[model samples]
Target: MELLAWGNTELDSSWSVTEKSNCSYIRIYHLTSGSICYSDTAMSCALDTEAVYILPSHAPFTMKPAPGTDTHCTWLHMNIYPVLVKELLSIPYTQKQALLFSLMRCIMEEAYPPAASLSHCAEIFIQDLYQMGCLEKPDPAFSPVLDYLCVHFSEDISISDTARQFGYTPEHFIRKFKKETGSTPYQFLTGYRMGKCCELLRKGYPVSSVCALTGYHDIKTFDRAFKKYHGRTASEYQKYFKKIYP
Candidate 1:
């Protein structure tokens, strides 16, 4: 995981925001004073000052502060795996606040926070969430394929061959994978690779090395895909993180 941006803002009663959808990063907000009504297609609720709200990637949402009241907030934007969003949301409010505040302090206290320290905190928080039984177990039949991809993502993968190895036909594998994971195998692999690319970049890996580490042999292809996936070239992404934390 990587911290993309952080802000502490005070907004008046007139403040509101509407987004057709959030971008690639996850958004987290803690209101220090007042409240806001948050609504998405699935649910609507008042976000109170004592709680934290984590809006996952690509979710459509809106926020409007209570009438006639000013609001104070601390917010963070981060790059993390989308699969973990569900689990993160399931964590209890107090636990979420504790973990998030620690993360905020790590970034705010230092002129130049170490990237590895941030990554380590994120990893530990994720592990604690899992230990709390927030994650849903994967379907037994699909677990093998998921495990394979997790271990072999840095290798050149062939969908057809992978299906055969796992006792599935390519057509059936595509269908079943989509049914189980809400994404096709290729989409999942690419998403995983791009996420790893970001993590490696934040760890100070050079672009050329990160490309090879993420299994893209062709530099040109990696460059194009990186730009498309992240809205910035690999070098630019690396430089952005360095400028913020180096």
Candidate 2:
């Protein structure tokens, strides 16, 4: 499932893993006095008043609470952008921003309506993401960088080179880039690389060849990073997604 929308309304005294990874659903569960363990080998972190989690698509995981556990909380799921997540982390630790969570609720409410407007909800969500420091408008020069990245994702490009080409010092360019894109040049480049890697893998490219084509130094590192970001090794991901490529 695409995980279009989801949230918890009334608090559940306790709930177990009825189903997991059937949908890309991440949720917030408020625990009254006990903790809920979510995962067998994966690790999760608490977000706010409740423990928040993001379940990667197709990744197997489990959730169970301690005996007598009682909790009240809301859960949400979204197709999030990596840049947006980076923006949220860039905010001051003390800041409590619920832009993403709030947007999910609004989208869900309208998702089933006779005249649901998901695109409108997306536009509003982008605004919320910007307001919450979870997204930012790219600088005018950023388009060049984006264009270059699109064409040369397989090349090893550095921020310093990109900065020089744009007539800005590395420090200045890095700051302006982050201000506009909510991600450092390195982070954005990696995201681009990962995206291309996914496409190449799904197109039936050999793992080692994909590593070379994607500018990864070696297959080992590429495999590790692929699993880290996509929750599946390149081979496994390709096995599932490759047939879908036309």
Candidate 3:
């Protein structure tokens, strides 16, 4: 997932937007209040309160405020390849959802310092949509990159090597990567490793395994980084969340 833009938007009776072609990026709108009606040359979808709306790239459409209501929503603009627009279009607007608030929180967190993993948030967003049966395709170009990182993060991988695997030069890769995901490779790796550590620890994996699993050859280094990133030592963090975990 390549993040182009993300934030909140409030639309009133006067609000309207029209897209010509897929417009290079897809937009996902998680409506928190009010309503909206979407239309295209083919058909329309009446989007009501607390719904997720997906506008796929290259699919021309227009969105307008629904009758007599204000609309409040958070939106994410991204490039998700092989988008299942038809599948997304057919989903019920008020379907039960998951990860909406958490994903938003991550987006907000990445907007500030110590900010990491906006890219991961995007991946989670995709995962949620896919889980909800909204997004059907998993052929996005970035999937391989993410999969590789997750499976091999324990190895001493470097940016240039990772970039080359993706068929890009070092300098160009950084620019392209940052543009697509809002994070550098190293930053993403740190966040990814920390996340993996958190998960493994939650699942009763010992810290030593997590150290190797996350590619930290040194226990002390891993401990310090874990503390800094999560604001607690691994033991403490695990203990804190363990009660809530079940």
Candidate 4:
């Protein structure tokens, strides 16, 4: 795991520029612009609107602003290795991926002010970030364990099964996983499932569907666990997100 830094810069008036990536990089650009051009191409896209674009590593790119233009945007640059990116894209793309990047961009923008620090907020954000992206390939043994939890998250997976897949004894696996992720396999799985349940409920999925999709054998068990982990009933959680996010 890497602690990446993020920041933004504003171009003065209108300008055209080119830059090189010292190492392979991936950039997510959130732009609000009247008009912009990339390289020699004229950008006829809508102006002064929200848009997102991806720039692959080491790709020479150019940007031009329309006359009398006033534009602003945030650029998130992750010095992602190719292997890591390939693994990240291995999973089916989901809106969660975009939201994860957006929140990260927000975090970098907000600068983690110490005065307003909140553990709950930090926990939720970090969990979402981990859930959104996959680790690079040839990762540590624990990396596969974590990835398995995420991909098979809807299944009733067990610590022993996770350990077996990684060719480690159950006891040894548990200790190493805890050391690396700061949570036991069971604890991590439960948290991951709970987070997915929240996402499903927010999308207005029915309780029965969320239960079935999240590997809960019964509605009673699902409701109980969801309430226990989130401190609210499923219905209450859905309503809460609607009000907060809408």
Candidate 5:
């Protein structure tokens, strides 16, 4: 995970925004004073002061401060894996304040390289959420399949074969996988492969090698899929990151 942005800010009633679609990064908000309402197509909720709100990536919602009130908040924007939890989570602002501020301090302090510290802090926060049972848990029945995919994503494996290997028929497996993961098996496989492709690319691997390593046989096909996933061609993505990091 990477910290994209962090800050404390005060917003007045005049501040309101509608996000008509999912955002690319997760949002973490620690409300210090006043309140805000978050609404989506399905539900609406008010976030009170002294509470922490976690808005998972790819969740579409709108937020506005209470009328005539000023809301003080510390917020973080992070580039992390799409969290399985889709709903906005409101947790009490207790011991977690230390963790959030620690993350901020990781970026603010120049005593040492911050990359490892930042990741460590973020990982702890995420793990805390999991231990608190705030995140969704995958079905135990599908654990083997998930584990298999992690190890064999580079291999060409058919959905039917995978399902049978785990004692599930193709149709039932597809349904269960979709229900548990919010995506079809093929979609999940493609996403996992694309993630690996990104990791390899960021490590300076050539696009051609990344394609084969991530299970693609044809360069053009890999290019198309990578572009669709990342909104940039493989070579362009590598160049873009190089420019930023160099």
Candidate 6:
């Protein structure tokens, strides 16, 4: 999923919204107070209290905010870029909301211009919700396995092992993983490792230590992938880098 735009807004008593055309974006709303009616092609729900809503991309939606002395909700608009999660979701108060609140603070404060850090925070928040079994289960064909890959990216995982874990044959696993993620499992693992390397290196981890901790067998191979993926060496990034999660 790709984050397109995010911010917070409070609609007062006179709040209003109109029906619109097709939407290529998924909207997330956290009702801090008051209420609103949300409707789309696939589902319709009310943000009547302290609740969170995740609307699907490409599903047109209209908002009908309730009128009162004090009425408001905060919303986030994200472009899945390609639809990953398959349904609209409304999650009520839960422990996971604490994580969402933390991420919201990061998105609001740390993500001033909204770059990689913001994306990373948002992804983490959403993934938490998914793991909480709140959002509609993802595409059964590949979504669950993708989640497994994301959560366990740091572990020494193999395609054959993961495929078998997901009850798929090795041959079928390669095809499905490639088709859904646009990269083989190994390639995706490498990319995830590299992203983590960037994160750690930027955080002042020593080169040799980072290499070893990131599961790199040697600095040479690590350097190769780092330079190839980031177009710069790890040390270079540490000296002149901004936290961007890619």
Top lDDT hit: 5
Candidate 4 lDDT over 1-246, as tens digits, reads 111223454655545645432223344455544555555232323323344454433334556665666766655444332122211112232465456545644554653422122223333433444565533233375566677778998887877877887898999988877566545566566766776776677568988999999989999999998887655788777776563333
Each prediction's RMSD to truth: 4.5, 10.2, 11.9, 16.0, 5.0, 10.7
Q: Lowest-lDDT window of 10 residues in candidate 1?
A: 82-91
TM-score of 6: 0.47
Question: Which pairs clash in model 2?
Answer: none
- Give the CA lDDT, 0 to 100, for residue 143 in model 1: 80
Predicted candidate 2 versus true structure: per-residue lDDT over 1-246, tens digit per residue: 122233445434455663332222223233323455555344543333432333432244556664454544444344333333321122232223355445445654553432134334444544554686544345555687767765777777877988898889999988877666555677666666776776677567889988998888988899998887666788987776543343
lDDT of 1 by residue, 1-246 (tens): 566556667877777766563344566777778888878778787777666667655456788897767788777666654343431252345876576665766566677766556556555655665687643444777888987996799898999999999999999999988666546677677877887887788779988999999999988999999898777899998887785556
Candidate no. 5 TM-score? 0.69
Sort all candidates by lDDT, best to worst: 5, 1, 3, 6, 4, 2
Put down candidate 3 lDDT per residue, 37-71, tens digits, no spaces. Answer: 88888887777654566775545678888887878
Ranking 2 against 3 by lDDT, winner: 3
Q: What overall lDDT goes with each candidate model?
A: 0.71, 0.54, 0.66, 0.54, 0.72, 0.65
Local lDDT at 232 for model 2: 79
Best by TM-score: 1
Whichever of 4 and 6 has more TM-score, that candidate is 6
TM-score leaderboard ranking = 1, 5, 2, 6, 3, 4
lDDT of prediction 2: 0.54
lDDT of 3 at 236: 86
Q: What TM-score does each of the candidates earn?
A: 0.70, 0.49, 0.47, 0.45, 0.69, 0.47
Misplaced by over 4 Å in model 1 are 1-28, 33-39, 57-92, 99-103, 217-220, 243-246
By lDDT, is 3 or 4 better? 3
lDDT by residue for model 5 over 1-246, one digit each (tens)?
A: 555445567887678767554443567787767889889878998887667788855456899998867788777666553345567888777776666665655464444334445556666776778788887756777777877986898998889999999889999999988777656677667767876776677679999999989999999999998887666899987786553233
lDDT of 1 at 228: 80
